[model samples]
Target: MGGNHTQIDFILLGITDSPCLQTPLFVLFLLIYIVTQVGNVGIIILVRVSPSLHTPMYFFLTHFAFTDICYSTVISPRMLADLLSEDKTISFTGCMMQLLTFAFFAISECHLLAMMAYDRHIAICHPLLYVTIISSRVCWQLVASSYLFAFLTAITCTWCTFGGSFCGPNSTDHFCELFPVLKLVCSDTHSSEMLIFAFITFNAVGAIVVIFLSYMSIIHTVLRMCSAQRRARAFHTCASHLMAVSMYFGTGFFMYLQPPSSHRSLDKVASIFYAVLIPMLNPFIYSLRNRVVMGSLVKCGRRIFSCWQHRSFLSSRTRTVHLK
Candidate 1:
């Protein structure tokens, strides 16, 4: 299979096969992708420029936005192209690369969410030690570790998946997802399937456990607070994160936790939820719910407008001088 494998290309069936649905789906997803990029990139830029957002919380958030951008990019452009193109073909190497990059960012996001939860837990549960616990060095280390672990896991999964022979059909129902691609493998896939299952379960469940415990402690801490103002403040700080985590893990568990034999056509819908919808929603979830981010956005907007006005005035003066 060596020589043949290098030349093989997989046909991705994409979200729908209906001719009528393609244009509308393309428009809808194109808008979503555009918003995903603008929103995530806006968050990154806001955090970078706003000193108020230079805290450990926003630090983690910037990385989270970046991860969303990356994984969303991995899926959306190709999916959009496939919607318009008659040939929905992706090279074998391209498919594997897509899987690897997407897995890396997606797994990184899981860990990043856990880290954000822990940051909130520290902020609310032990406010006195929050600064000490989540210092700059600690934040860097946590972010680095998350990416490192995700990369290792992604590479391992990719290797396991592509190591198997693919002499049979080269078409998959969805994008280059683990299970869908695995279905195309002609070799005995028991070991690969088991390995992928173990890794996915460990990543999802492990992150969820961390988030669960963190929020549980946070709940306990918030309940015991003597001041209602402090309690409301704590909940407000966590609300956006809770929404994001719920949407992410909820869709993730639905997509990956089931048996390969039980994977339905609905899995494609679930994939769209996490891979596309969640990323587009995350920036809004955080920014709209967050007073600090919203304030920063307003300030940035004013600055941009002020600069534009100044440039227009200067240009008008130049025109007047030339007319004279």
Candidate 2:
């Protein structure tokens, strides 16, 4: 206990002492970061203002936009900072905070994606009962619950994780993460890692199962539809959702479930996918593919332009009045 306490106090508080890699990495990440923020924020605004996209699927798509924004916010800023700095250092508390928030939104995204799958399921499976089954109230509930579940789960996971002592050698090889951080803990982390793994697995794999089943049910129901347009619309609605799910899960599951025995590059590659690429892709996958979103996007763009034009005209009138 004494040694443990001493080690904890001696802990290195910031990011890794590794030298910064600037120029290329910084500029690339900066551009991607800008694009990601713009795209996701754009999606959110478009959906929120568009009456045509106020339905359940678009409602969930709005959450997807939000998830992209949040997920990127959790990781990208620090990454961009580290790229510019000499040491890629993060404080112990800061790292944990990042891990917790990232995992929270990430897990929320897992469930959110599944909830969206369920939304598609209901839409395709029970078109007649879609409104009755997935009412506006229920949609809000799902959204709210995803947030609550994410918060609670992160608290639980962080509690379990931090309960174990990180006794020494806090040089996490890659970035802010649970498993990599856990490995640095000098205490007996076998049980802790196991527990963390179980929770992670449940969130990751369990979501995959639920999403798969929901899609299966949706497919079964959609096949029964006699109308071609009905089938086409159903397929289109679910296609975008499935694509988002696959991208998220494919990168995520590979990252977590891959044997630790695999190459060291594995974690970095996987982290890049979930930590960066996934956020950049999510809004595009969910919104740009949808016709309603495209129409709303155009309308929103025009509205913004008109507002700018109106402001310019008003400013000209004000100048004339002042001159007079």
Candidate 3:
């Protein structure tokens, strides 16, 4: 019944409330967050610096890694802090902002993965036309469109979910998510819920459909390939992306597709899977099996080592010259 909802703060009852589990949970998430940042950032840096990674595939991959970094940052820090601190209060403005940013990146990533799948399809199916089909301009356009769509969708969802009376409890069982925040609204949320469901379906399910179709074509093409070695290479190239897609889409669908009434404690687990675990795992998923990425990492490491050695040698030479 408050007009100034902005002045109110919502207490986020994070993953666990047990006093004994707090410290251990904090340490676990802290490590996950650290690895998520380091791994995703490493991908971005390698793609930017390595000439071998300057292709359309890597271009999409670089943006995907950046998205993962952003998506994790939106949720992890607050969640990690809440795990340690007794007060898990998030201001209304902060909560809405988090929802907005999180939705934007999350939706963008869904579309980005779809785009990457299309890229792979083109590369595998029509190798010669891959360059012409997915040109630099087209890549930029695809990425921009993904972000634009995500931003508009985020604004709509955030507004629809929060543009109502909030007379209920100021505490949510999970993070500042659509369903949790909606539970606090005093107004009839049927329209907002329907609208959000449509958007989630469009973003998540739609992306899955696109990825599915693309991979189907890719598989058909690979299966028809005359060279067994080429077919093996094609499958290898796709394996990492497919793995990432399965995990991200699986957790996302599990979290969002259920009836709000059916949202159980497992919703939190699903949330953590897509929001925290997926980002941390994406780097390894994409890079570990990727020969190009692995080779680039080695090259980058050597370059860094050589630069450090050169700096040390220069410092020693300067000391000798000063003594002479």
lDDT of 2: 0.76
The order by descending TM-score is: 3, 1, 2
**Candidate number that wins on TM-score, 1 or 2:** 1
User: CA lDDT, every prediction?
Assistant: 0.92, 0.76, 0.90
lDDT of 1: 0.92
Poorest lDDT segment (10 consecutive residues) of candidate 3:
1-10
Badly placed stretches (over 4 Å) of model 2 are 1-21, 259-263, 307-324
**Candidate 1 on 160-189: residue-level lDDT in tens?**
788877888898865798889888877787
Clashing pairs in 3: none
Model 2: per-residue lDDT, tens digit, 1-324?
112522232132222344453566768888888989999888887877988888988788778778778878988887777666656566667777877898888888888898888887787777799999999999999989888878887877776566666656766644567766666666676676667677778777777888889988878877888999988988997778788877888878777775433536456767877778878887778667888788888888999999999999999999999999
* Candidate 1 vs candidate 3, lDDT winner: 1
Candidate 3: misplaced stretches above 4 Å? Answer: 1-7, 317-324
Error of 2 at 5 (Å): 5.2
Give TM per candidate.
0.94, 0.88, 0.95
| Every candidate's CA RMSD | 2.2, 3.2, 2.0
lDDT (Cα, tens digit) per residue for candidate 3, span 295-324: 999999999999999999999999999999
**Which is superior by lDDT, 1 or 2?**
1
